[model samples]
Target chain A: MQSPTRAKKKTKATSMDIAHRAGVSQATVSRVLRGSPLVNAETRRRVEEAVKELNYKVDRHASSLRTQRSGTLALLLFEDPTPDDSHINPFFLSMLGSITRACARHGHDLLVSFQQLSDDWHADYEDSMKADGLILLGYGDYLAYESKLAHLVAQGTHFVRWGPVLQGQPGISIGCDNAEGGALAGRHLVAQGRKKVAFLGDASTHFPEFFARYCGCDAALREVGLRMNPALQVDADSTEQAGYEAAQVLIARGLPFDAIFAASDLIALGAMHALKEAGLRIPEDVAVVGFDGTPMARFSNPPLSTVVQDTSKAGELLVDTLLQLVRDQPAQSITMAPTLQVRASSGG
Target chain B: MQSPTRAKKKTKATSMDIAHRAGVSQATVSRVLRGSPLVNAETRRRVEEAVKELNYKVDRHASSLRTQRSGTLALLLFEDPTPDDSHINPFFLSMLGSITRACARHGHDLLVSFQQLSDDWHADYEDSMKADGLILLGYGDYLAYESKLAHLVAQGTHFVRWGPVLQGQPGISIGCDNAEGGALAGRHLVAQGRKKVAFLGDASTHFPEFFARYCGCDAALREVGLRMNPALQVDADSTEQAGYEAAQVLIARGLPFDAIFAASDLIALGAMHALKEAGLRIPEDVAVVGFDGTPMARFSNPPLSTVVQDTSKAGELLVDTLLQLVRDQPAQSITMAPTLQVRASSGG
Candidate 1:
């Protein structure tokens, strides 16, 4: 095996070297290198073979130097309130796959890391010129992180974040219409003849996404001339344990709720387990709905019903918007539409 | 929000500038920068405040030039043979979290990307000198990718992969003892009085990890003087759908198997669904076991029993080994022991 470090010391082959080896003109070599259709397949193959033989590399650094851009983007994932050490939210993992594909499609390299909220986090990427811009995902508490976002803005950092797309939020943001998603779940449960629907997730400013979802659900219930019972709202994070404890709390309250709408699938799955342990049959007794249609939702005991965010579109838009900011172009916040995925848990 | 691009042009403050502002000597500044721990808490706090105030950067590029090393590691994830567009294996995702943390602990930046099997994939990092070394994960078919690994080896690329720790493989690898994991599962099944055990996974050389697992299970069965029924093994990939189909195949063959050991949690989950659909009570008519002990296993109905690889240890070893190779030190392959997480599905 050849040592790559030793091979790198050898001078890089130029297009002229390929042209000499392939017995083609330099212009033809350039045309082939540019992937111009003007070059025929036979000639292109010959040029490619010569290029491979010479171990040539296009000097991306030179191009980057000219543009003053690293041609890289950083993805900062904030720790989620998970039950285990992984800390990553399963929903973010799905979104990560889409974002990676989108970056590759747009000719950008991605640098992924956990969001370190310390003062030096920005210096780790942007200040070091490792990436041109940043894409933030999974802010634990929106209110707690709001000041940091403002600090980033004050420093003139080019960033886009995934969160509730509310007015006056810092920087460019891309997110699903959480309110619409909540309303969709509420309507579905109401249509199933579930009158007393309980909510499991913090519906406060600290968790803006859950709050928006709660408002939407509230509006949906009110639209049908029914008011949400405050006693049925239980605060919980997006974790199975949190959901389980919240359900226990709701059960302890002795509220006669017939349906439960968890802000996330992890929460809903935990709630289902708790309800089952309490001798309640899903859908037949207490219908359930969840947000973030993760793969686990499909395999849940009753196959959870959820509001599906368009991750592919979300990823594409996030990358595109960040690139726009990197290039000094105007980028706007975006809120994507949500679709309901009805499964056995909701009696769909 | 401040524009990061605009902030880039501002002359960055130096350690001397920080020292002057903090009313400390340049030597004291250097000591604080190196984290000598000799400095008093009050002095450290003052220096840190000054450093933050001036927005100072450590000029990583200057240090990198002195050492011919990029101070970065690349993690290449090969697309798994999954049922959906998100080709990432859940097991690898868990590994990713550990690897990321390990990199941070070692003061190295991580560059993450999906492994594109095309020829230019190596050029994406090693040839370009973007990263000092590579940590590879998830090779779908070892045989198909063997030549590529050889090419990387010939090029003197510093890389370590997660796979079966066997002789004659092209490069260094870190993996769990698949054979031991298989034997552990077999012994547990035997203890449960399950004599007829079905294996659902491709146990051939093409998938070395799974093949090792089968060999271990075979050895354990032989030790107990119980031969494995060749007709009971059904080939399937590590996916829920594939597991479901393989189980159906096993059932159709009229094999009186009381136990099923799947190659992955996904497969076991799928098999359990099929068994429930066919009205077979878990542990009464059939018991199931799986590998990769992912989060989904805990949540699966009846809960899946699985072989849990120490991903945290594996990640640390993989990073440590590759760094050894990067520093021109002798690095050896490592095999970690697996633990059996006996859950409800196996009647544990």
Candidate 2:
């Protein structure tokens, strides 16, 4: 009843057939059958159904020898030049929280560290079997890290970063829509009858994320017959001190601006302090808006109105996407939508 | 030229003599020379001096062959029943920052995870060679953790906790002086003529840290011919919602309170909102004080006056103490002093 060739090639063809029927790669089916954490819930279900539908024989011994897994993920935080000893920027705290919870849910142990001092970490972490993959978080000059990312790709390291999702980037990235967030801030301020809006952040390709925000705000303003004055745009990193200094510079330029749109909440807070020191009443004299609705925004001096990113969702997707890559599955860059939260600072 | 018996026992006795001269155990000398991160600066200095003074021949081969070390520490956070999805209590954010920096200083990688999900972590972490030691952080019922800690000691797993430093505890602990912190808050409020001071926290033996704070505040009030009225105190955990509800409950009693000292900054923030809703003016109708000098306290509506724990120092000490235990060296419970930061809420 069975053909000789079909019987001889039964195991190999059945596995391939199972992969085809499950709409997954053979590697994913192997991962699912071996109980790999890298396989997502949906993929596992599809693989299992395909096995049953094909009447595939179970090979427990072979599945047990699939590969060694540490069931661990490492989070390498590229240090922020924080104003305080808390190595984390307050903005990353919420992201860290979501990542921690996500790791727990996926049953993967998370190893956290600053990427500053560790040398050859690209080889030391995953290649040494310390973790199954790496989750990178930080804000730095994109140009400086470009070569390092290329090296990581050359080494075939499984890593995912929380940054701007750009084409031809070395690794998969899960990011909040920074450009849309900037536009949202701009649209909100324009609706409040503010004509001139000054931006606080480095608007250069060296920092792609900030550059996108700058362009997005500029585009939004142009729609209302207004464009952001590059002369009014002061370069500032994501720190209250930097923000304060940038505002002082903007004020000294003698530029008449009706409103300020900071790229970050910390920058907005610093600018607010400078404006208040200059005796400007918020919303009455200078309407202000900030991005990144961090918890601190709720308690800011005037309660900052800002663009909010769903960090929890970003974190969950980051973990899932990294796992997918670890399991040799196809994964794509993800850009999440940002919502506007209007508070006292925006004259709301 | 050496006596036959002395020559025969030379290597062993000389090592012991080095240990005796260094005023450290033989194990510590070995650890120091092997470049163990477990040894502190002072201890390593002593051992190095002893080696030079004794003219001990450096055994390169044996030193290189010292026991396997992971150069890693695991941080297990005992979860707080937080009001939000940010798994961490904001108080720990500074601590985490300090700990991360501290780990970097010692050249050790840190693995951070919630202790709630993983069962048999005591065996899973150190026993399975995941880490050399563990640094535990959380604010939970001490009664429930007491037995588990005892088991950790039984299994000879090295660990240090961030909690109240008590005598005869299962393991070493590094903690802030809670009693002193509470007294500092009470003293500041009393200086403002706040007589009827209300306390917000579960001040019971189950929560020894809060209980100590409660007693300390009560003692400070007694110094001014006043004591904490049991009716004025409300039981609340370390959450803003709990603080808000506790404040509502306190206000519902219709008892007049001139001051409120919350156990945590989050609780204080919550209570302040409730007080404002009841049309009470802060630092006028009621002076408010909180514990944990978290950054959020800076942006509170009236800027909360808080008792500041030296989280940077605490984190450093926690790592140092855990390393001491990992090296099989004698370690003690450390209690760091707390300082008060008076803000607008305290009528400063």
Best by DockQ: 1
DockQ for each candidate? 0.31, 0.14
Lowest lDDT block of 10, candidate 1 chain B? B1-10
**Candidate 1, DockQ score (0 to 1):** 0.31
| Candidate 1 Cα deviation (angstroms), residue B340 | 1.1
Evaluating just chain A, the predictions reach TM-scores of: 0.85, 0.80
Model 1 alpha-carbon drift over 4 Å, by segment: A1-51, A58-67, A80-83, B1-52, B58-66, B80-83
- Against the true structure, whose TM-score is highest? 1
Native contact fraction, candidates in order: 0.25, 0.30
In candidate 2, what are the lDDT values of residues B234-311, reduced to their tens digit?
999998889999999999999999999999998899999899999999989999999999888987788999999988
Cα error of candidate 1 at position A111, Å? 0.8
Candidate 1 lDDT tens digits, B23-131: 9998798788768889999999999999888887654454354445778899888765433566467888879888887887898888888765543575457665668
Candidate 2 TM-score, true structure as reference:
0.81
Error of 1 at A238 (Å): 1.5
Kindly list the per-residue Cα lDDT of model 1 for residues A1-348, writing each as its tens digit: 222232233444667888999999988987887678999899999999998888865544443434456778888887743336664678888788778778888988887777555434755577666688899998478877888777777677789998877777777789999999999998988889888989999989989999988889888888898767778999998888889999999998986999999999999999999999999999899999999988788878888999998787888999999998888787788889999999999998
Docking quality category of candidate 1 according to DockQ thresholds: acceptable
Candidate 2 interface RMSD (Å): 22.9
